[model samples]
Target: MMAGEKNPASCYLDERTFRLCCRLFLQHSETIQDGWSWEQIKGTDEGFMKKTVLIPVQSSVMHKQHGCFMQAENMDHLTDDIQSNVEDETAGVQAVCEIHAVLRYEYHVLYSCSYQIPVLYFRASTLDGNPLSLEEVWSNVHPNYRQRLQQGPWDTLTQQVMCVTS
Candidate 1:
């Protein structure tokens, strides 16, 4: 394993710790319970076993709006040219939002991983206690990316275990 990678055993042990954290958050805050679980793709090849857990966040909503300066357009003659230009600008803004969201999510994961915690999770609320759907959490993503996730393999597992609590 790398110097900072978590061992597989730690992942199993930390499951309870993570669950407790989730329960605490659920009790006190609007914690979203969505995560990715996967075995290390190259564990045996490396010295120690490693595993990864990824938690989604709604915090991306803020990151999605940064540095978005809208240019003022003329009010006269709103022809096809003007409409096309406006659409192009909006598309660029959407692209920027998507990139910002993905980068922010990655940075958060890296920062959380630096703590040497076997289970890394993201907390986004203080009290609302509202559950977030995957579509809502990933709302900033591009249509194609969102569509792919909506139809991804995890969707099947989520549906199958919708009623099972953490």
Candidate 2:
């Protein structure tokens, strides 16, 4: 049986049988990893204004497969900076505030891809879940790349040659 599968009611009636079935399923599933859990970095008082809460989960696969560890402290620092700015007198409170921060872990076996690339993507918003602008988001990026990212042809690739084959 697969994780999240709906088993027959009769099979679940016996506690021992149900436990056995769960154990079997867990032992066979590729997605199941030990010690995976979520932790909240910020409280409601922080500028998060969204109804949806954010939680960060530590992922072993991300480290083992991608050769990269998702730094929880980096995300925490970003949230903390935003919170401090809000509390400061110079930066007045906005109509929307950050309410939650979450991290998600996903495991997949892609046969077509040769390398496992660990990509870190972040979304920031008002409590209502509306996304912040690039400027707002880049405020969290390292200063050296901030200016370059804003005005560079980062996404555009130069074509080295055009080829014609007979």
Candidate 3:
């Protein structure tokens, strides 16, 4: 094996080994700054378990006027839209309210016997635990990941192995 890589296919994920894996992984993450808290969770699989990590939402931002996050180029279009809705007297400038929202993420990793690899299932939610829609989740993922997701299912086996937090 190489540094920072785990050979998942080389090791069988039985109940005992899965428990140990979760413990060791959790222990290692605890030493890192701002590490997301993880816990061992029981799975429906006869011989395997899962590791779940929960990241809580930290804050909510209120925008001065449409409470939205606008890219530099989009601001010009937004200004035009705002001006069109108002009288010519205020055509050049207008005030809008913007709101920026953040979400919490929950991830579960389990060994899939059918695929012979580990699968990571994650979801984004509000502070109260209401889940985000598929479209919203797709939008939230980094653009680089969008293509990987479109490739197919079970592709996450490799994707999970490649994911690293900076």
Candidate 4:
């Protein structure tokens, strides 16, 4: 309910409502922005998948803009390694890519069904998407999120891509 809070469980919308909201938000963003776009694709579940990208303008500081993909997964969808590696106790997962930053970060949120909380499973990397040593990633991430990233796996989900001008 509060704006700009760090907790995902605090999100009032449930999964179905959240997906619908995402679609609607994407539609409005397209009308108001020159370089933002998103589309829904079929999902493993009855829900939908969404991929969004925001390209920067000529005056922007970052030269490259990378597309980010986010999707949710139920407990049954997780791999054995991921299931075991994630320390958080949760019933669902949300995965996201962060290639737009100077360092790439790939993280998953595990939603605790009972508590309605979201726990982060995260890892970061160098600009080329090469896996950083745990120490390296530890130093790069903010102090607040360091614990989550440190507790999670070492793989990154995003790869560098050239900006598309057209």
lDDT of 3 by residue, 1-166 (tens): 7898978866656545655676677677666523434443467434322233322121222122213344455545654554354333233332332222334455666667676555577766643455565555565556788888867735542222234599
Cα lDDT for residue 65, candidate 4: 33
Error of 4 at 139 (Å): 3.3
Locate the minimum summed-lDDT window of 10 residues in model 3.
Answer: 57-66
Cα lDDT over the full model 3: 0.47
Report the CA-based lDDT of candidate 2 relative to the real structure: 0.36
TM values, all candidates: 0.21, 0.24, 0.46, 0.30
Error of 1 at 56 (Å): 24
Whose lDDT is greatest here? Answer: 3
lDDT of each: 0.35, 0.36, 0.47, 0.40
> What is the Cα-based TM-score of model 1?
0.21
lDDT of 2 by residue, 61-131 (tens): 22332233435556565445444543241253232122223222122211112222212233444333444
Per TM-score, the best of the predicted structures is 3
Off by over 4 Å in 4: 1-12, 28-102, 107-123, 141-166
Which of candidates 1 and 3 reaches a greater TM-score? 3
Q: Which tens-of-lDDT digit does each residue in 1-166 have in candidate 1?
A: 9998888765443434544554454444333422222223364421111222222223434333332222124112222232334323343434433322211221121112334454333332211223334444456456777777667746422311135578
lDDT of 4 by residue, 15-44 (tens): 665556556766785686422333333664
